[model samples]
Target chain A: MPSSCDEKIPRIEHHQNNSDVSITICGYWSLNSRERLRLLRRWESLVLQWKDVLRFEIKCDESLVWDSSLVVFLRNANRDLSVNGGQVVFLDLPAGLNKLLNLADEGQKRNKEQKQDPPSDGFLSMEALLKPLDFLGALVISFLNLVRGRSVMRWRDFFASARNCSASALPIVTLISFLTGVTMAFVGSVQLEKFNATIYVADLVSLAMVREMGALMVAIIMAGRTGAAFAAELGNMNLNEEIDSLETFGICSVSFLVLPRTLALFVMTPLLTIYADIVGILGGLLVGTLVMGFSALHYLEQTQSALTDMWEVYSGVSKSLFFGLIIGFVGCYKGVFSGRDSASLGKSVTSAVVISVTLIIIADAFFETAFSLLELR
Target chain B: MNVSGRDDIVIRVESLDLAYGNHLVLKNISFEVRRGDCLVVMGGSGCGKSTLLKSMVGLLAPLRGKIIIDRDELWLNGDKKRKETLKKLGVLFQNGALWSSMTVFENVAMPLEIFTDLGVKEVENLVDYKLALVGLAGAGNFYPSELSGGMRKRAGLARAMAMDPEILFLDEPSAGLDPITSKRLDDLINELKESLGISFVVVTHELASIFDIADDSIFLDSESKEILAHGNPKDLLKENTLTKVRSFLERKTVNNS
Candidate 1:
């Protein structure tokens, strides 16, 4: 920085052989005073040397203009010098700097008065465990209130979200299911053609699509699509205080906003799953007939024989009902409790989809095990 | 609404007409708000007081005619010149409209930080002083949602005064407060008018606030779609012969004696 240290803008001197030990500062000081690295080192060592000399006097220059940087330096110096319950009483050093320091102290006092430290996000924390339970309890009460005609629920939101998730989502869901069926059929034919059992490809693709793939695919699609949408919409509404104005009008935001979104997902998820199942079976039929040179009627007959009853399709459709509920509940939960910022809202949407997908897979596995245990398969 | 053509007039609306789509709200409206005047724009609900206020503040362009704020035409001036002219105004919305994410200190300091190159110490001092002026000295750390309704208004007022604008436009400052809180806010407005000597154009229908703070006022009529009365509101209440003006000013609530 400066060309030389001869600019004694800041010179911390250790006074000795005096009635009172005094640390004296002289010359014009400012933020430029910080550029004196040599003086800073000398000041630190002097502080270390005079740790016991807690009572000292502060001397100032007559022609010095300073800012908060000086106040910050002195406060830090005070903290270092008076480590053992000694008072660093600041006498007069211009009224504005004193007022700034006093305002800083008042800010600290106000923060102390509002003792709202954010709760820890550890999994074992009691509050974290209880939060979901509390949200569910409120949601249940709000639902009851709605059923009893005591609360306002936006039916338009329900219809709008239902239309969005079901109709608008068909294109991607169809493409994914069609590709999955084609892949399954193509792979099954490779193994079966070697043993001259190529016709069984029809059985393989139909059974997988109806029993396992259909509901799972639809649930994952909805989790990423509709569930993430729910989280973002509610999170924005929460940030803008639209939800708060609802509360001030004595209307429950859960009933007014969340209930409609959740209900839309619940009603639409199963319908989309059924449509996906049919489209997937059509995909398999196309591959079995066109690629394998089998007649469409024969492939249909083989699929019918593979599924002798409605039991397999019923099982997948029933699983989709709970899948719908999981997606709806998780999405709204993430949204309704989202933090108050754009970044946090983005995280809420991501976590809504992630958590819903994970839960859907876990629930599907449990359903598979339950069906096996009951010998329903 | 226009009467005198004195040089002290800070804002002059000349033959201004405002409209939304096909419906014209105010036609051939002319007004002059003199310097250091607390001019309350009062009317019944949906009389377009807010629309008139908005037109003057450069948010809405006039369908026709001109709005001059301190000799700078709002619509006729080019973008760069208009922006400089707009810095002379500060506005408070119907709600506090404080940014939800920022603390009260950040909210009040935002204008200073953006428009000026003052140091952190000065910005902090100015923000603290503005908050103190609004009686929210210790509320710098709280968010808008954490504040009560009255405190939210005061914080918004503090932020409005951040740049020391020549005119402050307040839309329904007493819209959501209790009677006592609204009265205290009226008193604070009066004190600011006396202390800072800044012009205020307040859009409200609150009778208590109008009587407490307005030095001059305009009453916009919905049916006629014009400013029917202008002058000191207290004087208009006693002497104005129009039933429309008398009925509005002398109207009493059943809960009061």
Candidate 2:
């Protein structure tokens, strides 16, 4: 019995002889991508009809000129038939086409074998839980080696990183810090204006800038800029096998790549934080004099009085040092351990920024609570 | 510059000089690739083999030379004409250079999409054909990261061949591959050359691959910063050529024996 399907180019003719089923593929059989999708959908329905047939034979017309689309269609059909306890055989194909089909089959088998053994879930695996501890252990060992002057921490790398972390970062830090201060002053003035306490807006802005906002904003900015740069650079080096080459040369990659970057950030961050605090106070002064209708002398006097206690400025600067360490460590960690591919490099850069920002916030919260308990607030 | 009778010459380099920021890499290099010829570029590491291939493919600018392709001066022409000339060529980078963000199908379809006005369906069909030709028939949906080294190289080759270019340039195709996979790649190159009449410029130091596929060959010496020898690999192995070339080929043979 012959049944003709609606597919014009790759028309499938189904025939049944007792318990045996034979499907003949006739016509051009060559289809573009959209047509291939439609053909696959049609073939899926046809396979459902042949579920009860134990034996299946597929024949391709000699006029057929096809490509991988045909292979995909056949592979899907074969898989469907096998699942339903049917055996399918291909016939009348060119030798090259047959070889291609066999190669595809081998690839599919290898993929299946790989898929059969899935990786353990991150939350469920003990190894995953210990990964952070392992990273910390390595960091400590590398740090100790550096302290002993036995590490391959080059002064040139440190100076270069210092320039990258400080000089290259100044413009963005200034812009962010200034804007943050302006926002704080504007928002605080609106509330203070109702009580005719707009003059106190200077106090609010100065206190926040010197205690939290300046360092926090700078840390977040660096996490996005410098931290991501580190990850991308190191991840690319890792992909190029430069890190492996370093190992072959008896050089410690961690000490050579990480220590300099972290130390540079550690030294530059607090200096930048102090600069950001001054820039932020100046921005608050701008809003007080121009937007809030306060005299410049009065705003400056209020800011000076509010920031008379140097402990607030010191706290923010100290927090930035830790934030810098977190950014550098996370960036270098993600990069050095990155998988050997461009996709992994992109992923490492994204996670470095994300993890650094998150850890900065957490560390800031701890600092805030500790300062509050000690009455430094 | 006469194009009256030399219809078979696909590419000609005259006194090519290449440099990177004042450091001369290859100098006074000249060669010609005839239609359907498989020309192997052999050299030791840092010997400017890749640099010469890059210049030939228009990825780099030679310091001074005339690179004539399909009877058109490659470097002398403006951007539009240069692009038109480049359309007739395909270069597969050493590391496969498959875009990590896209699947194998998308990577192969990129050239067809950019260069041709084919509808999406037609592009898909042609991409499938190219992938099948490179023996990656069912690996279309897989990303480059998921593929093994040999599979990635095949995918790269499929992408390079997507436009059905007349001249194909492969940089170290068999590097980092096992002997069996290398042989298979060599066989595929020869098959494509014979079937499609595509001229190939392959840069490789693998002696086995050079003997298996090269119809003609050129040797670039790093220390001398020039082409030391140019001829058929089998003939060069027997003939009294440059000492470097003789030792380079014989050392591999000696190691194998």
Model 2 off-target regions past 4 Å? Answer: A1-25, A32-112, A116-129, B1-257
Model 2, B43-146: lDDT tens per residue? 88889998898788776788998899888888888654776787788777777877564699987886666456899999989988998998999899998889
- Window of ten residues with lowest summed lDDT in model 2 chain B: B248-257
* lDDT against the true structure, each candidate: 0.81, 0.83
How close to the true structure is residue A323 of candidate 1, measured as C-alpha lDDT?
Answer: 93
What's the DockQ of model 2? 0.02
**True lDDT of residue A9, candidate 2:** 63
lDDT per residue, candidate 2, A309-334, as tens digits?
88988999999999999998999888
Q: Distance from true position, residue B43, model 1, in Å?
A: 31
lDDT of 1: 0.81
Top lDDT: which candidate number?
A: 2
